[model samples]
Structures are given as structure tokens and as C-alpha cells.
Target: MLLVMTGIAAFPWPAATAQQKGGFRKLAPGVLTVIPPDKSSADELLHGDLLEVTEGLSGPPENLAWEPQRSPANTTLVERARNRSFARDIWCLEFAFKPPRMIEVDVPAADLKMQRKRVWYLVYRVKNTGGRRTVVDKDDPTKFKTETFETPVRFIPHFVLESLEPLSDAEELAKYRAYLDRVVPTAMEAIQRREDPRQRFYNSAEMVAKEIAFGEERWGVAVWTDVDPRIDFFSIYASGLTNSIRWRKRQGAVINPNDIPGSDMEVAMESLRLDFWLPAAGGNAAEQEMSVGYRGMFERMTLGSRVLEATGWPKTTKSNPAAALERMGLKWGDLLEPVGGGGPSMQPLEKVLTTIAGLKDPAIRTALVREMFGDVGEAALESLAAAAAGPVDTEQDKRRRAALQTMGLTPEQVAKDPYKSLARIVGAMDSQPGYAQRQAMAFKCFGPAGRRLEWLSKGAKAARALAAMESIAIDPNSVATGNAQTAFEAVRPSISALADEAERRKVLQGVFGPRGPDLFAAAVAVHEGIDHDWVFRYESDGPGL
Candidate 1:
């Protein structure tokens, strides 16, 4: 049995006594390599050289080996690191198995109900390690910083098997041989046909949508730079891996985290590359440092299949807020205060009614009305009906009006509401004579002269004159203003097919003098509430027409 230790303080390593410990080796000032204590049971199949602690380091030392040592109480190992400017300290507390032994079972055939693979497990405990308080920038809300102490734990490996244990019993050996014979060739063929795990890793839903959760089912790699630990803005990923070699390669072109994905196994894996990160507006000082140098630390834990299954670490199940609310028969409006507080509320009623209109599910809307308002449902319904009865003058109405006008429509035919406007436009287009009449009606409603008056009201005399002329050409009856003759004379030549360019210019100049175009532009700009300088500014070509 593996020895259990407890209640240890930070930084327990002394340089002189380090070598005497079973298999603790110092790789760097604050980094140490730990090995399992039961050396006899550990074996070569474990790939000792590829142990996570030694290989996962940023720059590991060459030509160093160590034996596994039973940890003293609480802390498994503590290492102290220092450079010219700062110091780092790591404290490791291990939670080893109760038995600290492997299960002995004959290898199962591939066709067996229980198919097993030799997969290693690792765990990481990432925390804020932020300062006592946070500092916000006065000028910029997005920029902020924090103070942090205590060096982050760099590398902790749960596995450093000392040696391999082989099947020695005759019956066990026979079973192992038979299992291999039955499975190896099939396994090789399957491997050849299977899609590349790397492709799946990159294309995984979790990878594309970098969402991480901090819950019981978290597996794989979780990295969060800006995390507020106090509010639980931290993410976790749990994964089973033989080593970190592949993960290290995949870490670049890093997909930044937005929110936590609710599901695990979104990405398929030969060895899981589960990844997600929690986000906060601001980041911890230590995390910032680690992120800058790609130097974050993670925890590693080895677990037997049975132990993992018992702990419920197999897959992540994401929670659905909408479904949850539905199951509770609750609406968002129910949680919000009324439009006007203290007495009866209108806001929730308004929101709930509006939302209900679009929902297809009868129960969704019914439950919203019955459950959300209950006693006040009648009052809410009355208010909603009143609001719906009023004139259609919303932003949507304005957009529909503008759209119909753009498509050569008049108010008479294109009534209020998108459905009516769409129907009118479609009806007008279905018959050529109806389309021509609609066009004529549009011209008559705001023919060139009337359009000119509108522009002048907005301060665009030249544009008004030009538009007024075009309208008259489309429909002679469009000129209905008191200055009808003057307006007609202004654009008469431009309307005539026999008029030349010079004749049109003379008519335009007579209606609006040489400076008319410039003044009209300024007037239009002012009417629209746009910057006058932007309207008048000249580009490389010239002032825009």
C-alpha cells in the first residue's frame, strides 16, 4: 500500500536532503520530478522517460532520473524558485488512491462487453492567485490590473512508474496471448480506417467554441487568463492522456475562450484534447505573467477506471438555461421588476406578451401568462391589447414605409405593416398595368415640384429642382404647387426629349443659379443632421457629386 501523508506547509524542500528522498529530483529552482514510491510494481510498459512532470516542462533538464517517493503528509512536494526580479514557490498536495494498486484481470477480447484501453489520467487545479483587491482604470473600463503573490505550481505528474510488471501466471499469460491474437490485427485495421484524431481535435465543437465549465464532469485542459476566482469564473478540463507531447503541439494557434461549452466529448480524440477557459473582465497578475510566457501550471492525477467511473468524470453534461426555466414554468419577465416599480408592473407584462406572440408552443405562451402573472394576468392582457390597438408607428413601421417607397410605391396602396406592404408590392408587380399605375401614383404624390419643396424644406434647392423635373417627366400632373408654372418652367427643357444638354443646363441654372448645387448639398446635410464638413470635404478626385 502507498503511504498516506498529511498537513504539510509550503516549500518543504531543502537542497541537501533532496537527493536522499526516494526519487525526487530538482529540475529547476522551483520544479521537481517526483516518482511513484512502489518501484517494484512499476514497469517498462509505463514509458518512464515520457513521464508528464519531466516532459511537460517548458525547458526540461537533460540526463536526469528519479525514483518515486511516498509524500509526507498533505503536500506531496514543494519547490522554491528565484530569479533576479521575482521568486516563485510551488506547493503540491496529492490525493492518492486508497489501495495504490492495480486491478488484476485477464485482458478481454475486443468483442467483449467491457472493452478497456491503457489510458492515463491527469488533473489540474487552476486558481486566481490574485491580490487582495483589484484596481480599475479611470479612463478605460476595459483596462485593469491586479496584484498577485505566490508562484504557480509549474509541473506536477501523477505518474512516474519505476518499472513494468508482466503477466507471469501461466493461465494469465495464455489469456493475454489469446486476447492479443484476437484483437491486435483488428485494432490495427480500425486504426487505419479511423479519422485522424488531430483533425477531430481541431474541428471539435468545444475547440471551435472555446467554452469551459467548472463542474463535476470537467475533463481535459482548461486555461483561463482573466478569471475572477471569487465569482467562480474559472474553468476546468479533464482528460485521459498517455503524455503531453501531442497537446503541446496543438496549443499554438490557440483558440481563445469565450464561454464554457456545456458538453464534453464535443471533440473526438485518440487521447482526449478537451480544452476550455473561463473569462473575466480583468485578469490576475500571476496568470498574466504565465499567459505572456506560455508558462501556466496544471495538476496531474492518475485514476483507475473504477475510481474514475465512481467519481462521475466520464463525460460533461452542459446545462440548458432555457429548458431549465421552461421545466420550472418560469419566464424571464417573472424574475424582472415591473416597468414602474412598487405598485403593479407593466414591463414584465409587456415583455411576456410580446415574447408570447412569436412563440409557437401553446404551453410556452399559456404557461407564461398563467404562471408569470397569475392574479394579474387579466390586467396584463388588457394593457397588451390596448398597446396592440394603437397606430402602427414603431421602428418596424418606419422601415416598411421606407422600403415600399424605395420600391416605387405610394402610401395609398402600401398600407401599414410588413405583411400588407409586401402584399401590395407583390400585387403591383403581378400585373404590368397595376405596376405602371402604382409608379404613376408615386410620381403624382411627390412629383418633381413637390419633391423640390420637400428638399427646400430640408435645404436642397438644386436637388429639389432636378428631382421635381424628373417627376413631371414621369407624370405631367405631378406639378401641383402654387408656383406650379415657375416649377414647370424650371425643369421643362430637361423633361423635353427635344432639349439638348445646353438647354437643360440653362433651365437648371435659371431655376437654381450656379451656386445652387453647393447650397442645396449644404442644406440637405443640415436637414439630415450630418456634419457639414464631411459633406463638403474634397477627396483626391474632387468633392463627391
Candidate 2:
């Protein structure tokens, strides 16, 4: 009996094993299943908290009867609040995302034909970091209460891959292209193998309606195809991260008492907005910095260089106004304040030359030299010459100087002989490359006309012409007067000498002569079509986004 008992005790029962040994339910006798280990604590983590700190009760208020219908004679639809807003600080989750990558996969089309398509995908993980907060109970908005049990997070993610290239600063809506997250069944297996075969990846819709409980994590990939490969900068808006929103009355939206108050308000989801710049290189995004050095302080950024870099958005520290507004759940046009304060309060550019032509001002024919070099003077001449010489390097002269310095040229060489000094180092860009730095050096110095204009000492043209132009802008009707004819007559001759040859005759005929605003209009139009708002695009292979 003792030997039988000993044998019975020694017999291994998989079902009877403790969870510490294996799983709570064993798969086999004497063989226990081990769960994969968690990621190493030592691994460098990109930490982002999706928990929103919430305050203020938005949406329709409880007891919302602005006008109650007490009788059938005054029949009205009873309004129950559609849904009470959650007054809880949005529960934050730990979020990590992988930069978008290109993967060529055998995508089976609707026709069931095996077609290889290019796919771009962003991989991300969300881990629930559970916490309790004293929040407003939805049942009674008036009463503030605390809840012990944290609500299960249902992640219904909306991933939008918006091309920054399309919304390139008020670019017309027609050229604006954006792609929604796609459901590509074929790409998953391939992405899994490429990223990590062990971890299961969920698509946008696949990950929906599932509760990620405390300490639980879910991984998902936002997939897109047919995206423009030429995009230099783009933002992948990951919404549904938090349920909190900040709203304000939409500009020019009128509020109706019968409608929900929120309907009149424009709402912005609290989301992770990540901005990326892709250099000309195939697979990298560059970081933005003061490209022209602010000495070594901003030297953290390479001068005149663009290196694409990825950034995290969820840190809670007080940030710059732009990011802070976003963190506080604000979007563009929320407050509707004019940017840069409507610029300077300068008056309209006058039709002085036109008025002069209508009068056929004869006094101005005195001498071309006197009109060009005397009355208009050196200061105004310089302004006209610089303006005519096709937008001299006004903003980047410093950057060009720095570029020259980077090219082993002294400050004196950069100032006195920028053009030739820049030439000596043109080849050095490839040998010792700093693109932005080198590109800054590449900025051509002011031309001969521009150089000559500077000889007027600070007064590019004499002060009198400039004084007339400046003061004329002060009075709305100044251009329509006899003084306007004389003033314009004096400034007209200078354009022949100063304006770009392509537009000089046009200006001389239209703006300076009997052509009036017509030819001057054409002369000005010569520069109108140029997309001066330029970004020198470049590309690189790795160490990108």
C-alpha cells in the first residue's frame, strides 16, 4: 500500500500544476507552457501617455430645458441629453510607434489575382496604465464623484496618413491627397515576418471593439498604399487614443436653442500628431533646426541642413504655444485670431506713375542722370536696384557667410569676395559634406547691380525718393495729386537703369512712360509666377525617420 501511495504521489498531473510552474491550465502532463517574457526593462522606451487630464463639463448640460413644454397644447419633443460628457481625465496609455516603412508584398486584389503592390505601414503598441481618478459620474453631471473601477479601454483607432506635401501651406484642395488606413489582408503576414513574426499585429478595424484591460497591451499596424512617394513631409494622425476633446464655438456658426450646444462647437480629438520630414533620400526623415548656426547654442542643429527626425508628442510638461495648444486639444481656427497681427499698418501701394502719365508730366524730362542719380538719390536708387535685381539674398546672407566660413574662408573673404570664395568650396560639398552648410554657401551673393547699389552707403537711393514713397503710403490720396506726378516722374528714370533687363523695357513703357500701370503691371507680373517659397529637396538612405 505504501509503495502504491508513493507512486501515486510521484505521478505528474499537468492539470494540478501551480500557475507559477506554467499556465493555470497545463497543456500536457509534466510539460508546462511558458508565456513569452515581457520586453526587457532595460530597453530604451519611447514613452507617451495617452491619459488626458480633463476638466470642465462640455456638451448639453443636465436639466437642459431652456424652455419646458408643460402641456400637450405646447407639444414639443422631450430632450434627453444625447450623452453626458465624461468628466474624467482621459485614462492615459503607454504608446509606442514605429516609423512608417515601405514593404513590397503580394497583395491579392478583388479579382483574386496575385499582384505585388507597394505598401507603407506604421506599427504601434498601446499598453493600458490603469489609475483611479475622482471624476464626474455620467449619471449626474452636477455631482462630482470617484470611481474605484477603471473603465475598460475600447480602442477604436482612426489612423489618417495625411500628406504634408499636399497640405503644403494652403495648397488648393484639389492637390490635397490623403489616404485612410486600408485593410490589406495580404500585407499582414509579410509585415509580421518583417517586423516580428512572434507578435500578432492587428489592422485598424480588426483591433476595434476589444477591451484592453489593466497592464494589457495591443499592437496594431496602420497600412496605406498608393501614397505619393515624393512626399517630403507628412503627418500620421492617430486618433481614438483618448476620448477627451476640446471644443469652442465655430467661427460664424450660429447657435440654435433647440439643437445640442456642442453641435455648434467645433471639436478636435485629442490625438497624437507626429510631423515628419523626408529628405530626398529614399528612407529617412530629417530633423528641423536652425540650419544657419546661431553659433554653437543652436549648433545642436546643423546649418542649412535638413535631417529628418521623428518626435514624441505626449509628454506633459508645458511646451511652446503651438504644441501646448495641441495638447490642450485645440486646432486651427479655434480662436480665429489673425496671425502676425495683420502685418504692419502700411497703406495701399499707389498709382503714382499712372497719374503722372495721365498728366504727361513734362518737367521730369530735365535730365535722365539728374532724375536717376540726383532727385531720386542714392537710397531710393538702391531700393529700386535691389528690388529690380530679382530679390537679392536678403534673409540668407548670414547663412551664406557661415557657409563660407565652413568652407575654410575667413570672414573678410566671405564679406569682400563671397562669390569666388563660395566657388572654391563648391566641390568640397561632396568631399566633406554638410548639405545645409554647403547649400548656405551656395547662396549666390548679390550681383553687380546689387553690389553697386550698396555703394550708396545705407541710402541705396537718396533719402528724398524714399521719403516720397514712404510718406505717399501714409496718405490714401497722395498718389492722385500733382506732387505724385512730380515724385513719380523723378523715380521713373531709375527703373531703366535698375530693373532686370527682361522687365526694364516693360517698366519704362508701362510704369514710367505713357504705359502707366499697364506696363508696370506686366513688369511686376514677370516675378509673379515664380514659386519663391521654396524648400530645397534632398534625399538620403538610412538614419532617417
TM-score per candidate, chains pooled: 0.17, 0.38
Off by over 4 Å in 2: 1-86, 108-112, 135-149, 166-176, 260-262, 282-545
Every candidate's CA RMSD? 32.8, 24.4
lDDT of 1 by residue, 217-313 (tens): 1111221111222221111112221111111112222221221221110212111112112223254322221110000100000001111211111
- Local accuracy by lDDT, each model: 0.25, 0.40
Best-performing candidate as measured by lDDT: 2
For residue 87, model 2's alpha carbon misses the true position, in angstroms, by 2.9
Q: Note the clash tally of each candidate.
A: 26, 33
The deviation in Å at residue 534 for candidate 1 is 63
Worst 10 residues of 1 by lDDT: 292-301
Worst 10 residues of 2 by lDDT: 303-312
